[model samples]
Target chain A: MSATYTAAATLPEALAALASGARPVAGGTDLVVGARQGKAPLPDSLVAIHGLAELRGIAETGGGGLRIGALVSHADLVAHPAVRERYTALADASAIVGSHATRHVGTLGGNVMNASPAMETGGPLICFGAEAVLVSESGERRVAVADLLTGPGRTAARPDELLVAIELPAAAGGSCYARLEYRRQMEIAVVGATCAVTLEGARIGSARVAITALTPRIVRVPDAESALAGGDGGAGAVQAAGDAAAAAAQPISDVRASADYRRAMAAVIARRAVTAAIARARGSSDSVPIPASPALHGADRD
Target chain B: MRYDAVLNVNGTDFPVEIEPHRSLLSVVRTELGMPGSKEGCDDSECGACMMLLDGRPVNSCSYLALQADGRKIVTVEGLADGGELHPLQRQFLAQGGVQCGFCTPGMLISAKALLDQNPAPSEDEIRIALSGNLCRCTGYQGIVRAVQAAAAEIA
Candidate 1:
């Protein structure tokens, strides 16, 4: 149990608390629930940063990119017009995270910093080339989202650092995040894939393919990206990308699914993600909804 | 160590001194004398401890009471106005939404939050809104009907 707690009024105060070894709590969806589930004990000391106005709101950065504050809730992301229109993949991931109540309170910073390989938003952030802005009493530094997440329930951030914001570069082309879920709500991804592709006429110019719940960390598959790039963005290219993702997968058996099953589903989910992304790139947004998972059901058989 | 704070619930402010680890649900039920919210999973998976914090639905079981300091909280007990049943409460009974009544409080709170945001929610919207609240007895059909009826009555 936490022996002491203080609600920080500003960024400097929160950073100072962290510098003193007090864990920062925002939303408390993960920290408090993890303690209840026996996953980890409550930190001896905590500083509530949820009330800090400096770490809130989403704003358009220079070059049409987005700077998302750490305290911005998942519901806020889902409700944002830019997130739904430009960062559709992120919207897809956020829209399906936990349930209504969870999304209303859960913060993107908490989700990213928690470093769960199965988290819904990590793959999209990685595909979009987002950056984690870390701040401490010393200074501020930005780390790539992919590098910031080191392992399950762990991050590269020091105990004295706090993730203040996530910065996404201007979105290009189209992207989609699809996960194999057992239920509609309050579900984590069993196996998920995110594909962001920019089409040059009929050919795919560039692509980013990331697999989730299939590796120790959510990672972009270079082999899968190579399979889709410079290709016709057709069935053959999509299949090759899926196969490459499956080959790159190193999943573990757990209560959700066996390692082999996750590996098999990785290819299916990746293919669906790529297909939806390509369709959106081709200006066919009606082909896939904000969350491509449910809309792309039975797509693998095709 | 216990932290002293005030939680405004249902337009009333109550001063409380609670431990840092105590949940908003525990503080409301034990300290504030409001036992309407149920603790189903103690974890956030079951929304039996759902409450409105600053007009947004949150799983109070996982919300730290210290974080709720000076924030407006709305429990199910606050739903009714002066011995009059809220539209949601009346609709739940009229639609047979309650079976065991274990999840009713959370369901009502969730429904209220949903209606407050979107007054004319479709069936799918209502289901998605109540997805966090688990009802083992009613199987959720009656609950869905109750939310829809309440929305109609309110609008």
Candidate 2:
């Protein structure tokens, strides 16, 4: 319970406090685990930035786009009206995160900064072409979501800078996030995928696909998108995309899943994610990886 | 250094002081005399320390009292009204949701929040809601049944 000044009025104050080497705690969902696990550095100081009014909203950018504050909790993202309408997959993905209690405290910015390689939000945000607003004592700069994550459980954000908000551009059609997990919740990702499609007449105007948790960082499967774009999204389109995604993956063996198993899971998740995105683009809510219990995946509980 | 805090447990508010680095569980149990919320893991892995903040379930052991300042706090001690157990508590007892009962309060609050939002949850939803809280005894059938029974009663 060691304390530091908890002033959270503005971003400048957070930046000034960062100069004193305080751990910036937002959401406190993931960081709390680190602290409880004795994995976090002893807090020379602490800065509570959850109350900065400037960093807490999901609103339209006056041009039919969306900007989500860094402090926006997963619960808010899942329930927000604007996010529901514009980025339904993002909302759906947020809804299925960890657990109900964890979602209430976990923030989008925390996930982005945490840069967990298997993060559910990263695939959706990157596939949707989201931009992050990072602020420091120097100034503010925007970086693409894909460029932000540097490694597993890591990010490119400077220690002195804090991510403030994320911006998603306007687009046609809808997107969907799909994941395959060994357990229902509280477990890390096995394989995750995001598919966003822009429609033009009956032809595919654009397609974006991103995969994470199986790779070192969130990897954009351009080959999958190109295969979908150059070829027809008919019976063979998904198979081609899945093939490209498998080829694109550079997954290594991990305790969660073997590289071999992850390769297969990646193909499955990619195919399902693309199919769901297409269904969503055609205006349907029947997609997304809806799991069934009683007969669950992975091993049985201890 | 000692950190001063005000803990609102059950229905009463108490003024207390503790080490700057002590956990909220310490203040609630040792100082405020409310021990319904057990500390199973001191770490976040175990849900033995679950409680409600503004009615949402959270791991109290993972937090500091300062985090709940001027906020509504509810604990297992407050789940009952005038010595009457909440419906979930009664159902848990009758349905054998308690084996060792170490994880009961955390499981109860987690299930309560789900039932509060979705009165008729599917089996998968019930499992997802309770994933954060773990129980070694009873194999979870009784806990799942209790939550389903609570949902049925509320519905």
Worst ten in a row by lDDT for model 2 chain B: B17-26
Tens digits of per-residue lDDT for model 2, A152-236: 7677788888899999988668777778776566655788888888777666668998887777898889899997774456758
Alpha-carbon local distance difference test for all models: 0.90, 0.78
Regions of candidate 1 where Cα sits further than 4 Å from its true position: A286-302
Candidate 2 CAPRI grade: medium
Chain B TM (all candidates): 0.98, 0.93
Query: Which candidate comes out best when scored by TM-score?
Result: 1
Q: DockQ of all candidates, in order?
A: 0.77, 0.55
